[model samples]
Target chain A: MENEIAMEDKNSTFVVLPAYNEATRIRPVLEDIARKGYNMVLVNDGSSDNTLEVIKQVKKEFPDKIHIFSLLINRGVGIATQTGFEAVLKFNPKYIVSMDSDGQHSADDLDEVIKPLVTGEAQAVIGVRPFKDMPKSRSFANSIMNILTRIFYRVNVSDSQTGFRAITVEALDKISINATGYLISSEFIREINDNNIPFAEVPIQTIYTPETQAKGTNVKVAFKILLQMIKHQF
Target chain B: MYLYALIFPIISIIAIIWFITRYFKGKNSLITVVLWSIFWIIVSLFAIFPNVSSAFARLFGITRGLDFVIILVFVVLFYTVLKLYFIVDKMQNEINTLVKELALKNEISLDDEEE
Candidate 1:
């Protein structure tokens, strides 16, 4: 099922994976997306590890399909994803999907996430995860973000912090993200609301390993994100 | 006179001198130098004659000079902090833009080499 969708719109869709210090886990994620034949944009956020070397090695196998971008230093995930967007925009793709590199987001769900965009049902699509399936701490943090996003941006989504989402090129043009951290996810929802863009949410499987859970937003990061949102409001 | 009266005036004078030196070195504008000098001079006067603060406080309808001084300090600190916050935010945005552009430029050059 995923293969048919991938082969049909492979050239028009670009998958952007923003990775930071994912040297131990990035290869399989990249290979999975590559095997699906989607054009890949891998942004290395100045990983202190040998993540860049690993990306370069993977690029050797699919040199034509894989595009590698390296930040000079460790900018946060927000800017890293924005960099990927800028790089992929040059190629003029129809859809740009941003994913995490920690193997939390499944490559199999790529088709489902992009289905709304393909069918012209929505301009932007967020791959929502079942909160019940998430770890308690992460689930609690995500719930808080969801409520805050609704309050601040006046847009409600079950998951505002999910990296697994797809946006059409036209919709992407109307949105500008200035956040340089995890708060970028919230910024996306704000932009969508501000621009009056059509959006949808699809349920995606959540695979949380201990490493993945330990990496992304924790309680302290959530509090920081709340502060950033308030700052932007004023 | 109290010990703070002597110490504060001396500190204010030193600050005024430093501001003048910075102006002479072209690191500060004339307006900035004048404003800072006026501020420090006022500080020195308030420290030398604590009664003047009481008089000014009466003019502002405040009961105590100490209360007036505390309020003024807070206002100044708040303004300074807000100004610094905005400057830092602008710098962060500029740095992000520079870094993103550099990364994209390097990728374009690599593409050119491949072609």
Candidate 2:
């Protein structure tokens, strides 16, 4: 069953889910993707809970639509997503779409983002959430990240921190990344800018759960990203 | 009896320090020190104060003072494994990001060639 599922993923677009200690929400997200007929790779980022166990159970139930990779220790979200990104690279997918597993990102918006990648209109496409659904604090943080990317990377992206993004396997290979959390999303955009990969943004609806609102952007996270940008400068 | 009591505790204390120093110098040396210290402590206790050694050993479930050293070594080993796991996890992510970015660039070059 695993081999058959692996073969199925070889010919399809890949969705990457970077999850950590999200045993409660991950299963529903996995089921949503399976229903959409899109193959996904869930990177279990060293979650101390039953996150890996949940994925194993899902794999047993829906072997073809979901594949998983587990890291032994809890790394940050950036590392977990990168693990999924690497696995998708091996499968040779048409497009790679990565989203969070905390139930903040909608699997339904995937098509809107993947469209550009599928049509070759852009090398990478990001789904930007409308401001109405975003908290004021988060909106402000996103603006700060965008301005920083423009200053360092010279590219003007609407929302640099949005996780709903799709890129071709080719672009995924070229950009060098140096992030392990929220900053990774920004660094990815900077990579697209550095390499001059054509990128597009499509407006999508984002529903902010209580969990997401509580976990909103912070100054420490911003500082970590600034440090990452400094490292890139050198 | 008085002389034996004073010398035995002193010897045990010295043996424990020596065991810890060897443990710090190299991990491999810890096993040797622990084993030999356990042997010596047990022998000294029997020769000097058999009743006290037997009573302490039964209460602690450790045959000798040196057996406690082996337990300490296991604790350190477990902590080391947990620390290494975290470091490895972080490093793998950094490497993966590097690879993905490299792949992304290669795709751009291919696109340029087609253009």
Candidate 3:
């Protein structure tokens, strides 16, 4: 009876990770998360590489420390994250945290992102990556998106594009998500604005790799973000 | 005959215009409106103008330009729907990936020692 009650209370928080082609680093990520004492979900976005192999290995070693969702085909990051959220809802977790699988976000920073959602101070808690690690052009683009989000939605968010965020199940239920691709970030801000949901941001560290720096947001993604925002602005 | 043809086309034209207006207002997909309007135009041309109908039959190996237009619109609409379906499919794929990851995490967290 005591264990049953404890299990019911245990579903208060969940850590969601969306991974694609991150075999080289996923094992270490899972290891690091294993030390943090939080539930972890890894969404493999249909990688065409050894990502699944690594996940299989991790599952064998830490069967309870890691869970893997191997997609049959590649889906965009937004959809993967949303699907994770919907699944976690069944557990009735009070707070949900979304982190990147590429090692860009630190598991240590999970507390900062989950604070607001857990405390009832804000409906959403976002991890704002320090501008120092980002390229100037990317920073400029994010700033523009933030400004636009504020001007159009009357809300101020430090980082609208950051993958690290936390929100309550209630907020998750209220927020609308229509985007399937890269534009989901903009759609998130739009939904939050349209619904007038309360949100806050905490500064978090960003780790950069040679590949991540080289693979910054492209023109096509930028244009998509702009078009998505324009669609909702009217 | 002329009056009947004119009236049918006019009504279709009005419907097309209304649909286009709604599309411009972001109430519908633009491609949807264009596809439907093109359909109505072809129907109107064949039904209202017999000279055009007969000219089309004589000039080309076609029987009715209006019928051709209907087939063309359906083809275009079919393609458009297919393309949109793929987009939705892709989106659903992402959602599935995310859900699977979450399920795995929930399972692991059960044994997570942080409590």
Decide which is better by TM-score, 2 or 3. Answer: 3
In model 2, what is the error at residue A80, expressed in angstroms?
1.4
True contacts kept of each: 0.58, 0.03, 0.24
Give the per-residue lDDT digits (tens) of candidate 1, residues B13-80: 89888988999999888987887777777777789988877887898999999888888778778887
Which tens-of-lDDT digit does each residue in A108-186 have in candidate 1? 9998988889888999999999999888898898898898889988888989999898999999999999889999999
For residues B7-38, write the lDDT of model 2, one tens digit per residue. 76688778778877878877547666787577
Q: Name the regions of candidate 1 deviating beyond 4 angstroms.
A: A6-8, B1-4, B24-26, B29-31, B108-115
Sorted into a CAPRI-style docking class, model 3 comes out as incorrect
TM-score-sorted candidate list, best first = 1, 3, 2
C-alpha TM-score for every candidate: 0.91, 0.64, 0.65
Docking class of 2: incorrect
In candidate 3 chain A, what residue range of length 10 has the lowest lDDT sum? A1-10
Ranking by lDDT: 1, 2, 3
Model 3 lDDT per residue over A1-234, tens place: 212223322346678877788888777777776655566667777788888778777767666656556555676777677667666765567777888877777877876677666557899877888776687887777777777667656667778778788887788899877665666665676676777778887899988877555443545566677776676565
Q: What DockQ do the predictions score, one after another?
A: 0.51, 0.03, 0.15
State the lDDT of candidate 2 residue by residue for A1-234, as single tens digits.
223333343347888988788888788888877776788888777688888778777777777677667665666777767767777776668788888787788777767777777667899988887865678777777778788888877778888878888888889888876577777888888888889899999887777887766553555666677777876687
Over 4 Å off in model 3, which ranges? Answer: A1-11, A151-154, A214-216, A231-234, B1-115
